[model samples]
Target: MEATSGMPRPELLQVADAVAREKGIDRDEVLGAMEQAIQKAGRSRYGHEHDIRAHIDRKTGEIKLARFIEVTDDIENDFTQMSLEQARIRDENINLGEFLIDPLPPIDFGRIAAQTAKQVIVQKVRDAERERQFEEYKDRTDEVINGVVKRVEFGNVLVDIGRAEAILRREELIPRETVRQGDRVRALILDVRREQRGPQIFLSRTHPTFMAKLFAQEVPEIYDGIIEIKSVARDPGSRAKISVLSSDSSIDPVGACVGMRGSRVQAVVAELQGEKIDIIQWSEDPATFVVNALAPAEVTKVVLDEETNRIEVVVPDDQLSLAIGRRGQNVRLASQLTGWDIDILTEEDESERRQEEARKRAEMFIKALDVDEVIAHLLVAEGFTSIEEVGYVPLAELAEIEGFEEEIAEELRNRARTFLSEEAERLQKRREELKVADDLVEFNGLSLAVVVRLGENDVKTLEDFADLASDELIEYIGDADNMTMDQANDLIMEARRKLGWFEGLEDETDETSEDAVEGEEA
Candidate 1:
């Protein structure tokens, strides 16, 4: 080791090694940072405009300082560029695009220069450390990681995860779960982002995937792919529901997750701060899955409305409270796990609703068909709830109704048709009075009744209807029409097309036709 100027200092290599070890960075990277710091110092000493550079020998730790001037045909920069003809005077081997390196003696560092060099080295080392941390943890998302809580700021926990620091946001912590400094915690790596400050590693204990990963760690069947976790829903430290499916028929997914004597599930529950878990067997059928998800409570029936992506669950009156759970937690978790909106109902409530619907239909039949109460009740009992059904069903189907003859069926059909025709005429008169345009009235998929309703809502012209959003149109039409969003969009687009809104766009019609075909296939 030498302290004199223009001499190699062997201690520099030892310093680089120590810094690399302490910072967890590559030795070569630390040496590069040292070289950059020396180069910055050299530039500050020798004119800043000069192309000054520095290098350190890996073997001897010898510092080399130089000014680089490119041998170019055109000299755009006096400090860094030199003409080839002028370069040949100094060295005959110099060629175009080659650099002429003029070595200079290394200078002793002053206090200010030494401090500046230290700052540069520290910044470069920190940058390398941040890059290393990001590369190490960026791909480790969704993995369970153990760390010690370093500190807490504004409810956010900063954990020291060995080589890096991760943040567990307050919202990501389980409800009512408290953590303090020096406490060991396990969480899932939800995300890793490269921000201006550094690479941010976000951890979450409340995420549903955290529980799934815990089960994977505790349950061999899940880790081995014998059982797959289909979905998970968590109410933080309170309760959770996990749906799983088994690939092997002999293996029961729920039983495997539960483990022998509840050992496996208890491990996960303990990690989750005593969160009660309900492990349910997943089914391909939505109805079956919903039933399985709502555990500890018996469901007598489940009616699925695929159009609305909702399910109506019917349970015994005594099971109502159990099905709903405290503050609707059970059904809410079930809905999240199954991805279906659930409406829980008791058997008594369902029965009353059925009777009420029947009564309404019977009254409608009595008024529309001019039938007595007995006839209306018969129609309702026979599942003929609409005048359209009575008018258009096969004559034999109506005649086959008990206590109804062919003549009576024929008479009922005639009366129903008359009532519908008269109603249509009345709606048409109303539509005319409301000044609804004929183009809108005759639009396909817009029934005369729907048109009248739209006119009542002041959507009389095709332009007005076209201006409405799908949801707005559905709202204005009311639920009686059962208009889906897609249907409403189609109707609006058709109106737009008729109003020349899509004019001069050659591909519009083709794209619309292709979409229609795809929709039909779907």
Candidate 2:
């Protein structure tokens, strides 16, 4: 970041240092970023006369700027850069890396010039701060930060952190939790991006760590070195699954986080707008950990696939919905937190899965009406995940099997061919209908082609405009001639509404009424 004044003021140095320390950056880094800002402004304003080279003194609180003429052999014939032999005439001590300060007095710099320099410094400092925040929060990635709700945007949320402000995009936010001005809310910093629009402070209450951080803050063992949080998966405002590790053998991380009367964790739950939190002890053993992560519901069996870090859990029939949570939120959060792809199944589903396996196995051995479970499972283990793959196995190989016959193998192959063809067609049709948009294609003049394409995409009801972010619409029309991205995005937004897209979606209730309902409920 830039120093506020030309000569480093004591207060300016202190502020820069504080910002650097809190953000975990070096003083030189901030200074370098500030100098770059001055250079850019100077180059833009003065072109070849961009002679100002600025530096901030580390030892002494002072800023110094110098103008230098480069040195080479020919000083008279060439003045752009100095020749080494001619430069030696001024000072025998001069070197390539060093430059001499111009002989101008400090009194020569005007008030207007000083003000320009100050403005440049402020801009650079803010830019550097933004870059620093992005770097710090980037590695933190999906973790959550708690802050007071500042305000609402057009479906966006503004949160006030102690040192920074963050924007929680509508899509990144959890669906259920209500936010209001002045409410202290917790959100996951989804992304921290540097853009001309500003440092895009991406935040989300939907992320899994909101609960994890809350527990860490609430639970003493976690705050101390006795316990470490391993992973967290949350559905936000509904339920969450957290895995914790204990460093001290004597202490139970899970129970410790829950507290004596559940008061500690309950406080976190209330702040989450009444979401449920499940704390489980994490394990290095996949089978055990997967089993624990899916608790509250009994896991009958857990089959872990080591290669893919995936797990297929079979829960009792009664606990299926509980294990899955509402709208598959439980498993989704767990999958995200644990970095595991979990396939949860009820006992009935497992039975059906097994039956499906058996059917495929029987298809492989058409000559024989039935095969033992051991043989069927063996066939599955032998890269035969489906009957179609088994058909690819050589008939000579099939004949070598104890139960196989050439005629039966031939029949199996024919059936596999038929099944595969039908399945491929279904998959192709599904993929086509799934909708892959290269974003909304923009056009100059908002012509007929763009309008027609929009209609074909089922976007006629202006509601579809919401799907296109401001940037994408602008990019399309930017190549159309004279339009800017900002102008295009705004035009599309307004045009979509004018085109009646807003009429399709439900009218949003007034904020006052919603707040009253929320207050009464609380």
Candidate 3:
């Protein structure tokens, strides 16, 4: 019922303070660990079933030991619980949930108990140290850190980063870069994870962000926010490309990063073991950015397909190898830096492809419209590629073609319309033969021709179409309809919604809307 006072053990407090300072942990945490050790020892001396507890005085460092017995109406455990009547014998004012504290004399720890207590304290302190390390480094991902190599095992470098040890794995090291014990190296803190043993700090020397961080360290403009490193792509120990942007109009990002006579970039290259770096200016336009990224190789034309996030780059025949780099490295790095898939082509190749496409279009028109080679060639030359374009285009646009009059334009349009109508009838008949589901036939965003194509591809039912991935649907329909991945996804999603696949989502949305309405009313 009364507070327990024990003999002072100031040496324990001193040890706790020393451990806290050395381990970079709170002194209270060390003291609490000491209390747990004392509690465990007390339970060993006293009955283990008794609720033994220990506390150290914050000021006097006195170790207090006691047994706690709960006062309850029902006494289930005789060792740690008592009936309310028995508890009231000691203190009548004690509440039912209150504990009856019986002060016990501190036991003189035996050699075995002392050893056990020491192990407990050491384990608790180690756990606290690991927790502190995880807390300190978890938020430091993507940051550059400097450390000395402590050891190398199986090509993995163990780095001593002052208070903590980090691992630079073999795969994350720059190729052909060597590191021995005691060598100081800079790496990006790729990740910090908590595991069963302790917190693991992972570092990488070959990460693109490591190069960007190096530039940030070397170039004052970048650190000062005048210039920003937008993206980086690296073939570690070989080559790298970095894109930079300047918020200040007068500051040239590329020139600033290059430093005086290329000093800054050279420093990064040296750190990366002579990895070649191409510092390019970043642009908001993907095409412009791609062109800049593929620098040192002149580009004649760039065609961007935004739907696919791909770009076709055309260069002179002599510059083909240079544009593509050795083994396509240049274009690959350009793709990574600009966030676009890049396909490089020589000027000659592009010209041949254009001519081939034109020839195919002319042949298709000649067969579909029953027109002569001259008429089809004129139509193809005027950029008409399909029967739909020829039929739906303004009569004046077709008549404007050289050597074509209004009468000829009208006649060609009629023939194109007739061909498309007849083709639609034929496809419809095929769709019927394929037993295409009516629901799939009526699905929005799909034309009768596309539906027929889908039926031919065995996507005859709504369920079949819904089961297909967006890319698969695009593949099944072919490029004749110019179907985009996004459109395909939308159609599939609509089909799934109609099949009640999104019922749970709809319920959640309805609940959210109702909650919003109720909140407004309140």
Candidate 4:
């Protein structure tokens, strides 16, 4: 706000006091802020302008401005200069360097100076009020706030709480709830942060406790502590799970929540876009808790591991798909709520898991040609596992390694030589087709070490993943867990791109983008 020369100094003081009152600040604070601002702007460049002082006496409704100037024996006797005679009159012990006070009229303020003072006073009062609001709300995290969705801009929801506007990002929005202009949306205040602009309000409706809060608001038993929430997990629009308990055992937490005709829950369900909500009983036993977590799955036996605080639920082979949920979401959320590592096991998965783990152990630290688990299995046929034993055996002793006839080893080497020869030709053609310059593409420049690895068929230039036998490829590579089945597909994309075959290769791109993959896991 700007003040003009037309307005009288008393009129300006009235405006400042009005602003301070509206902002819940003392009138003296606004007057002091305006005086400091004018002094800071008009004073010398060195230290602060301590010579200036201002007062707003509430009883008189008058303002006074004064400047403190030092007195000297040979007084300068200027407009702002004071004499030792004047200084010693105020205090008889006053020395030559002692300061004397002189009052300046408020009417002396210039037009621009008055405007600056008004702006400073308004900003200072507003900032102090915002800080006070931030302190009041800082400890109220996860508590509900009634707000109106003010506007949606750039996919962000601007909510108008009574005191301020809160920003709810799209990630925190519920799938079922679409914020529209002027919609009265209730949200939990996730965080309170003080910023220069004001108190930053972080609001969220998708938080799991939103369900508990809604129930607490609706159900008298829950509000009065008759029913207690045990656990809650939500998938926003589609589903929610809440386990509750009764303290007195006479009143049922679930029944009170569901109401006689499911009236209470229906209010919550409707607010959540009719999301399916499962209200279950909580149990102290880990087994029962785990079973309840994996709802609609009907786990037969829950194997609890105390050391890791994990639960292994073995479901029927047919029910395995149900227990894990679509994309394993059901069990994943259950594990998050229970703070347990959940392993959903089927009879077949149990068997395959053990066998695959054992197979990995048999493949560690073997040389390139001896890396195959199938080859190791065949070697075990004649009692051999370590690479140290394989190197000592006769050239004829390779017959002990699976698929290792001296002749097949020779054929394998020959095949690699031929593959490399064809690779050079294929790379040359690809370079031409892709318009690669001589400076860009190289075929004969590979290191001998890399050539040797390729020579042993340890690493092959992938043509495509769908064509390559992944199970067999896993046998050839030793670091089984580090490499995922998806990597196999990605390798094919890399080879295609290197060969300048860039068209329509979406099924796989490369390992760098695995986390940003477009679809659900295989």
RMSD of each: 5.7, 18.5, 3.4, 14.5
Ranking by lDDT: 1, 3, 4, 2
- Per-residue lDDT over 1-522 for candidate 3, one digit per residue giving the tens place of the 0 to 100 score: 554777887898899999999999999999999999999999989878999999899999998889999989888899999988888888889889999999998778999999989999999999999999999999999999999999999999999998899999999999988899999999999999988889999999988889988999999999998999999999999999999999999989999999899999899888999999999989998888999999999999999998878899999999988998999899889889999989988989999999999999989998999889999999888888789999999999999999999999999999999999999899889989999999999888889888988988999889999899999999998964888788889989989998899899989999999999999999
Estimate, for each residue in 10-87, the C-alpha lDDT of model 4 and write its tens digit. 764777778776776667666667666655544422234346555555444355556677776564545445677876
**lDDT of candidate model 2 versus the reference:** 0.67
List per-prediction Cα lDDT, in the order shown.
Answer: 0.92, 0.67, 0.92, 0.67
Model 1 residue 143 CA deviation in Å: 0.4
Q: Estimate each model's TM-score.
A: 0.88, 0.50, 0.93, 0.60
Q: What are the runs in model 1 whose C-alpha is more than 4 Å off?
A: 1-6, 71-76, 82-96, 438-444, 469-471, 484-522
Task: Show where candidate 3 strays beyond 4 Å.
Answer: 469-475, 484-490, 502-522
**Count of backbone clashes, every candidate in sequence:** 0, 12, 0, 0
- The sequence of per-residue lDDT tens digits that candidate 2 reaches over residues 453-506 is 444446543446556666655444343334455555676667566656776453
> Which regions of candidate 4 fall more than 4 Å away from where they truly are?
1-17, 25-28, 37-50, 69-90, 94-100, 347-522
- Where does model 2 exceed 4 Å of error? 1-70, 74-102, 105-118, 121-151, 158-160, 178-183, 186-204, 245-250, 281-288, 299-323, 330-522
10 residues in a row with least lDDT, candidate 2: 435-444
Candidate 1 per-residue lDDT over residues 30-84, each given as its tens digit: 9999889888898999988899888888988989888888999888899999999
